[model samples]
Target: MAHKRDKTPRLGVGGELWITADGRNLGSHARMGLLRAVVEQGSITQAAKAFGISYKAAWDAVDTMNRVAGEPLVERRPGGRGGGSTRLTERGQRLLERYAQVEAVHERFVEMLAREAFDLEQDFSLLKVLNVRTTARNQFLGTVSALRAGAVNDEIELTLPGGMRLVAIVTRGSTEALGLHTRAPVVAMVQAGNVILATGIESMRFSARNQLPGTVLTLTPGSVNTEVLLEVDGGGRLVAVVTQASAEALALAPGLRVTALIKASDVLLAVTV
Candidate 1:
């Protein structure tokens, strides 16, 4: 007789759950398990033994969590004849309960993701986008709407999602190496320092190739420089770092209309393979 083949999926999704506060890790499954053990054992020594950790290590973890949480999650009970007991505080119990609820929802999400991730190549591309990190303050995703080739250089025009246009100048060799073509998706990166902020230039001509008009959304002043964020026409934001003196001279303020001037040579283009 022929045997039936196993129908189980070869690919599965799994993840560990963690609780964090202010970007600092505060709790995890192993830590929560230690807390649960303390509740059941009523002794730090016993709990550490059951949790497969040293007693000192367990106490250190509890102390760190308590300090980060701004309150004690575990407390010591006065000893009688045997010894003092360890117990979870009210807040500790609530944390475990909430973690359980969130973990259930997370498990369901992972299940859905695994089911939909049959196309690994496409999903991996999206993961690549999420993992992209750069020092450039302004990164725009768009398509190459036009390209002009010259003897030694090429000018590339990118059309942003909201129909806004950006011009970049790159070497002809770089363009050919990137295989750039019209309608090809690309990322344009411009450092905040490279962007120039201006106001009242409606009829004036500028040497910069890209001029984006927008309203100043925020101004973060540092000791020597001010970082200005502008909300442009296509729901995109551009960040410009200028000298505090220059910012004061320009009278830049939130909600004030301004324009960002970027030279084509200052813009950098990138594409994902």
Candidate 2:
């Protein structure tokens, strides 16, 4: 008689799992795996070696995980004869166990799903439809606060979170075709190149239709241009691309206050649907 194989052949899908707490990512497979290794190895150094990662990277991952998880996943032990050791806390053990259980169930579900025949091309098309990419540097999700329809064009006032408003100009036909109305949700996009920044103004006047005062958040300098990010009052942000020389002349840095100006006509509007 011929010998038989002990395990049956099975088809399954493999993927990594990332967990989050309250919309903040807590940790992923590698980080959590490091936690488990630390528990087994009884030291972070050994765990890092086993994982083939730097000690600093392992420590940083642990710190971030604990911070984002809102509790300590690993705790340091008091120094002993050898040295101070690192071990996973109770929460870490529980998290690892929970992840193992979920992974088992997910594997089973995916195997079942794979057994069912489906059109992969159709699914790929749906994925493409769901992903929308745009070059505009500033995009805000808001609701139409007011609508002014004229003979040829329509003026829309969009209210963002924290009661900030942005005005956009579009043709009347486009507005109606997009089903845009008061209180309707829309996203406003403005290119960074279209924004103007100003600072140290006491009594200056400008013709820009939209003037937003905000604090400089970041400045990224490139070859010839610099990208400036400002946090607006209430809740919003504006990005401006300016010459590096201009950034230096203005002395723009983090926490320095500035105003972003954009013409209403430059604000592009889009609907989710």
Candidate 3:
């Protein structure tokens, strides 16, 4: 008897094309469309209408692009009988042509990615992790190693890539809301201010649930506070902010071994949907 074939869906890759000048956004697909419309219609008002944007908004975009490019892309042409018309400058026309070439190449690149990638979902998830930003200074990507449920809170054990583990205490509501489970990927965040630093605590015990020992990588002093960067074991880094006086008291300096103490509750857990 013949067996049935699997019918699982596959993921695709896609991206937007943008041109930048001096780190500033100069043009995009929509902006190029507006330029093309101006070339065909020969009227800013009509171009704006075709581009589905207000006249002023279109002018603003054009002005920004022109300023960033250090050259006028679109210009007004004096008309004899009818109102003045709008047209693209020589540079503007060249820019449009070049953008078309780049867009075609970009389309092919995305198509290749979609066709050649064996697992697009994992690639997309990695992109999402790289794109995450937060005010917290410490961010670690790890997987859930264990979970212990409590009456009102849940104890979560996260294992980092280098074999180091971190424990976090999150409310029961958050545990359910994040859909956290064993072996699930998660991001752990801890603010610099929440981290405490100590030196020569090899034999002493700490009430804090997390004690990460590492060498002082760097110490940055500020007016009132000092930023300490630690190169922890398992190839992870932790940043801690301590007062200038406290930093001096511990003689915190690069190459000195120190421990970062953090409460289990201070670690924030997040997962991508």
Candidate 4:
């Protein structure tokens, strides 16, 4: 007998977007959930694991979010033995309400599109990676937790938070120039363009150079622009802003799958956090 088929990933739209009153976004789907969890659960650690993310990444997402908004969405007391509880300020709660309204509409729109896009069983792929660029993708700090030499290039692997790891291709000279070593921390960033989005698949999985799973933390709304937040797995966050129309087209939400794309050229390495 023949087996059943799997669903293809398709972009969905028609959801409500949650943004701060001042117009700064919190983060994207999962990040938003994490924010809410921090409020509901009372700790970043709890929220992170509840969402299948790492504690550091959750707080990192929160920190970047705080920086972006010019306001602290989550505030911590910082001295309880069991740890203080996390709560969303008035701003965070309001943001969620608005997001839900938009989400309902956006989901319906995407559902309609899915019907006509193609067979749900069609094989389609989706992925997210991490990259950073400053002077160039060439100059970045990276760790040397593991290495394998290939004829043309050596495969260098580094450990990152959120249980995330990064792999790089470099020549012996380049590796030596940077002095890659074990237990050393490096920064990783990716160019935005290397990231791709596809709609119609029920679920998404990625195996690119580096993929960080983050929560849709917040959305910043502007007359012409929209910012999306992603709270990564290892206590890191990503923010992407684009046109309002594009936000509508993507059907972004507060509890969506947010993947950060990393490109070799866009990734920047640093010795420090």
Computed on alpha carbons, the lDDT of every model, listed in order, comes to: 0.87, 0.83, 0.88, 0.61
Q: For model 2, how does the per-residue alpha-carbon lDDT over 66-138 read when each residue is reduced to its tens digit?
A: 8988989899998969989998889888998898898777666555455432433221111123345788878
Using lDDT as the measure, which candidate wins?
Answer: 3
The TM-scores of all predictions, comma-separated, are 0.54, 0.52, 0.55, 0.40
Tens digits of per-residue lDDT, candidate 3, 1-273, equal 897868766866789899999888998999999999999989889999988899999999888888999999999989889988999999999999999999998887677667655473332222233455588888887899999999999999999878989999999999999999999999888999999999989889998999998999899999999999998977778899999999999999999998899999999998876
TM-score rank order:
3, 1, 2, 4
Evaluate residue 17 in candidate 1 and report its C-alpha lDDT on the 0 to 100 scale. Answer: 86
Distance from true location, Cα of 127 in model 3, Å: 8.5
TM-score computed on alpha carbons, candidate 3: 0.55
Better of 2 and 4 by lDDT: 2
Error of 1 at 138 (Å): 0.5
Better lDDT candidate (2, 3): 3
> Residue 188 error for model 4, in Å?
2.2
- The C-alpha RMSD in Å for every predicted model, in order, reads 18.7, 21.6, 16.5, 21.8
Separately for all candidates shown, the number of backbone clashes (residues 3 or more apart, or on different chains) is: 0, 0, 0, 62
